[model samples]
Target: MQIINARLRHQAALHSLTMVDGRFTAIQAQSGPLAPQSGQYDAQGLLACAPFIEPHIHLDAALTAGEPNWNQSGTLFEGIERWAERKPLLSEADIRRRVHETLELLIGQGVQHVRTHADISDPSLVGLKTLCALRDELKEKIHLQVVAFPQEGLLSYEGGLALMEEAIEVGADVIGGIPHFEYTRELGVASMQQVIALAVKHDKLVDVHCDETDDGQSRFLEVLAYETLKAGLGPRVTASHTTAMHSYDNAYCSKLFRLLKRADLNFIACPTESIHLQGRFDSYPKRRGVTRVKELDKAGLNVCLGQDSIFDPWYSLGNGKLLRTLDFGLHICQMMGHQDFSRALDFITDHSARTLQIADYGIAVGNPGNLILLDGEDDYSVLRRQGDVRLSVRQGQIIAQRPAAPLLTPPWLSA
Candidate 1:
């Protein structure tokens, strides 16, 4: 397969791409032109970018809103209670059905690589098992990475550590923890040690839901950083939803930022979920429930944005669109400034690819033949208009394509 007469964003001239055996074999820009093969796309001067990466998500429990009951309180704790009520009734068949549907939705939105957390706190391990199967079944279409997430606290839940280890044995790609939900400070520290040890034992990546509370004293992020430094897992470790960092004192945060940079830890902020869940206890003059995205980036740490939940217990509204997530992130973080807005685009594409540790994951020659075409002329234009993906191609094959919709005008508006 060859794509000719295409203009990449940074390139000086139009180029041609040849994909063979699912890898880009050649890219010719200013040299000799290559003839098009049976399949060819002119691109029509549209911008080409790397496929979107969904670094953090929960596939096992997605699209299950109001199953047993709705979250009347709209609080994180209430959502947890609702999920607990619904977990007992989850079957392999039910999980596979929803997981497949969710993957299709993501694909249609131009997502080719995804890292989903599966809850292993339940003794059944039904969700983890179901996603493991689905991961293999959908390998050709999408790359699904599973994390053995202890949704319930490790020490608080009965046999939680054993279940987590069992999930790893049954083929989980990453090890996950939620320290803020533990019973006590001692238990939280112990749980971090347990998560790091398990990752070492299994030689897998670490991604923890660390310090998700709004309390200014929530300091689990420091513990996670220390453990990452001790284990020597520099960039392979990820800290998702460190929302408490937003409330921390600036004097403390200034010092903490240096340590995070030293540890080279990756950060993921779910702006939509954080803004909704945090600030629940605040009165007037509320604080934004997101981590210091701009601060972290300024300190040269890898930071990305994640769409944590989609129509799940935690969040009941999501269309599985990464652009929507980016939109919320820019507004909440106050990153709408000129240069900052351009970098905000990286929060979804490049920064996320770094968190996932995807190899050769870009629009380059010799990389995997996976990319997307947007309905805008440039990067900032795409973000400004909240552009939709016009074409989603994987392995040199068009998996999903959308025709442009005609604008609708009313008679009354014609005046």
Candidate 2:
């Protein structure tokens, strides 16, 4: 397969790419009219780059909004309660249907890599088993990483610890915990220690829902970072949705930043959900309820964006597009400067690939032929318009493609 007239990222001239046996074979500057043949594609000078990656998402509970009741309170706690009310209704067919639909939405938008959390708080382990099966079943279409996530606290909920262990035994790629959701601070600290120990014992990665609360005293992130440093798991550990850091004082955060940098923690910030689910308890001048993205980026830490939920109880809206999430995150983080816009695609592509540990994930000669062509010429234009994906290719096979929407203007209405 050949892709001609492709405007690769960070390149000035148009280029051509050749793929053979699911691997990129050649990439060079286009010198002549290399017309695409039967098994080739013509990008037509559209911006081409590696496919997008969803670093954090909840596929198990996707497309389950307003099941028994809606979250009228608009708070994170109420969302949890609503999800609990709907947990018993989960079955293999239900989960499979919803997850497939959700993945289809994602695949249409050029997402070829995803990391999803399967709730292990229930005794059935239905969610975990189904996601594990899907991970293997759909390995050819997309790379799926399953996390054994304890939505309810390991120490606070009955048999939660054993259930998590069972999930790992069944086949979970990563170990996950919600430390801040525990009953007490001590329990939260203990949960982090247990999560780290289990991950090390199983030789798996760690992704904790750390400090995802509005309380200023929710200090579980500190314990998580400390444990990550001690275990020497640095980049292998991820801290997702540290919204409580928004409420932390400058003095403590100053000291905490040092520890986070030393630990080399990877962070996932769900901007759309955080802005929606957080600050509901405030009266006036509410907080943003988002992590310190700018500070973290400036500090040279790895931070990426995620679409945490899609029509789930926690967030009631989504279409499985990482660019939408990146747009919202850039706005919320006040990253609208020219330089920021130039580097904006990193949030959804390179940074996320690093978070998921995707090896050889770039537009290079020796890499897999997984790339997408958007309807814009550059990062700034693509993000500014929330551009459409013109073409999507996976392993040298065209998976999805769409023409750019045309605009018509009457002569009388022309400016």
Candidate 3:
């Protein structure tokens, strides 16, 4: 398969890429018009880049907004309470349908790599088992990494630790915990310790929901980072939704940044949901419930963006597009400078690939034939217009395509 007249990042000249046996075999500049050949895909000078990665999302809770009752308060706690009401009604078929539909939405948007959290606090472990099964079933089309997430609390909830262990035993690829959501600060600290220990024991990666609150004192991020550093997990550890850092004093954050850098931690900021679910208790001079993304990037720390929720109890909106998240994140993080905009796409692409530890990602020789052609010339154009994905190719095969929306103009206007 050949992709002709595609614009790759950091390359001015149009290039053609070849894929053989599901691996990129060649990439060369298109010198001039050449004889048309069979098995060729004409990109028409569209921006061709690696597929988007969703590093943090809740698959089990996706598309479940207002299942039993609406979260009128619009708070994270309210969403959790509503989810509790809906949990008992879950069935394998119900979860499978919703998750598969969500994945389809993501895939249509050119997202091929996803790291989803499966709520493992259920006594039945239904979410974990279901997601694990889907991970195997969808291996060909998507890379699904399942995190055994204890959504409730690892120590506060009954038999929570046991369920978390069982989830890892039953094919979970990553270990997850909600430290701030624990009953107390001590339990939160313990939860982080337990999650890291479990991950080290099982040789799995750790992604904790750390400090996802607006309280200036939600200090679980420091504890999680300390645990990651102590365990020597380093890059294998991710701290998702460190929104509390938005409220931390400069003095403390200045000190915390050093620890985070030493720990070599990866961070995920879910702009859409965090902005929606956080700062609910604030009145005048309300705060933005997002992490310090621009600062993190400037500090040489890896930070990525995530959609976080799509019609879930926590956030009642989304269409599975990371670009939408990027747009919101860029505005919220004040990352509108020229250099920042040039590298803004990395928040959803390369940075996320690193967080997920996708070894063979991106468009290069010998890498998997996974790339998306966006309907734009550059990242700014694509992002500003929220461009459509012209084609989504996975393993040398086109998996999805969206036709450009036609514009109609009067004859006088056209002339």
Candidate 4:
């Protein structure tokens, strides 16, 4: 396969790309003659870049808004309560339908890779079982990683640990825990320990929903970091939605920051959901409820952004576009400077790939032929307007394409 008239991120001019046996075999300047191939495409000089990565999402509970009832309070706890009310109603067909729709939306938005959490707190493990089947079904078009997430708690829920272990045995790729949601502080710490131990036992990755509350006293993040460091699974560990870090005192957070850096843990911030769910308790001088994105970047830590919910109990709006997530991230983080804007682009693309620990996941030779062509000239333009992806190609095949809009001219200026 040959793709002509392409603009790579580091190139000065449009170029051509060649794929052979699902790997990017060659990339040359457009000035060179085209090579013979089975197929060809002219991008019309559009920019081509690596596909976006969604590091944190809940596929099992997605697209479930207004199922039984609406969330009147619009708080995180209310969403959890509503989900608890709605969980028992989930069937295999119901889960498969929503998961397929969500994955299609993600693929249309240039997200070829995703890591979704499946609730395993239930003894039946229905959500995890459904997602594992969907993962196998969508393997050719989309890459999925399912986490055995204990949305309730490892010890608080009845038979939670046993069910989580069963999920891993079935085919879960990661182990997850909601430590801050445990009954007590001791239980929270114990939950973290259990999550790490289970990951080690199953040889799976660790991604924990740590300290997602606005309380300054919620310090499970420290426990998570300490366990990751002690277990020697730092790179494979991820801490999602540490919103409590924003409420902690400067001195304590400063100390914790040092330990987190030492752990080399990955951080994922849901700017869209966090901004909406947080600051509800404050009458004035409200907080952002998001983690220290700029601070973490400055400290050389890997920080990524996630559109945590889409038309679900937690959030009421989303279209699976990662660029929209980047737009919100820049505003909430106050990262509008030139350098910061460039880095914000990485928040959804490169930084997220790092969080997912994807191997050979870039636009380079000998890598899988997965890339997206944006309707913008450069990164600045892409983020400035939240540009659209005109084309999405996976494994040398064009899976999705957006038609180019027709050019319009004013009637008053007609020749």
CA lDDT, every prediction?
Answer: 0.87, 0.92, 0.91, 0.88
TM-score against truth, every candidate: 0.96, 0.97, 0.98, 0.96
Over 1-415, each residue of candidate 2 has an lDDT whose tens digit, in order, gives 9988888777778898999989899999977556777867778888898999999999999999899999887789999999999999999999999999999999999999999999999999999999999999999899999999999888899998999889999999999999888988888999999999998999999899988989899998999999999999999999999999999999999999999999998999999999988888888999999999999999999999999999989999998888999999999999889999988899999988888888999999889999999877789888988977878899999888888788989989997
Candidate order by decreasing lDDT: 2, 3, 4, 1
Which has the greatest lDDT?
2
lDDT of 3 at 141: 92
- Among all windows of ten consecutive residues in candidate 4, which has the lowest summed lDDT? 30-39
In terms of TM-score, how similar is model 2 to the real structure?
0.97
Q: Which digits, one per residue and each the tens of the lDDT, describe model 1 over residues 14-69?
A: 67767888888898784534455577876665667789889999999898989899
Expressed as tens digits, the lDDT of each residue in 55-106 for candidate 4 is 9999898999887878888999999988998898999999988888999899
Query: For residue 229, what is the lDDT in candidate 4?
Result: 92
**CA displacement after TM-score superposition, residue 337 of candidate 4 (Å):** 0.6
Please list the Cα RMSD from the true structure of every candidate, rounded to 1 decimal place.
2.1, 1.5, 1.4, 2.0
Worst 10 residues of 2 by lDDT: 31-40
The true-versus-predicted C-alpha distance at residue 243 of model 3, in Å, is 0.6
Candidate 3 local distance difference test against the native: 0.91
TM-score of 4: 0.96
Q: Stretches of candidate 2 above 4 Å error?
A: 31-38, 410-415
Report clash pairs, candidate 1. Answer: none
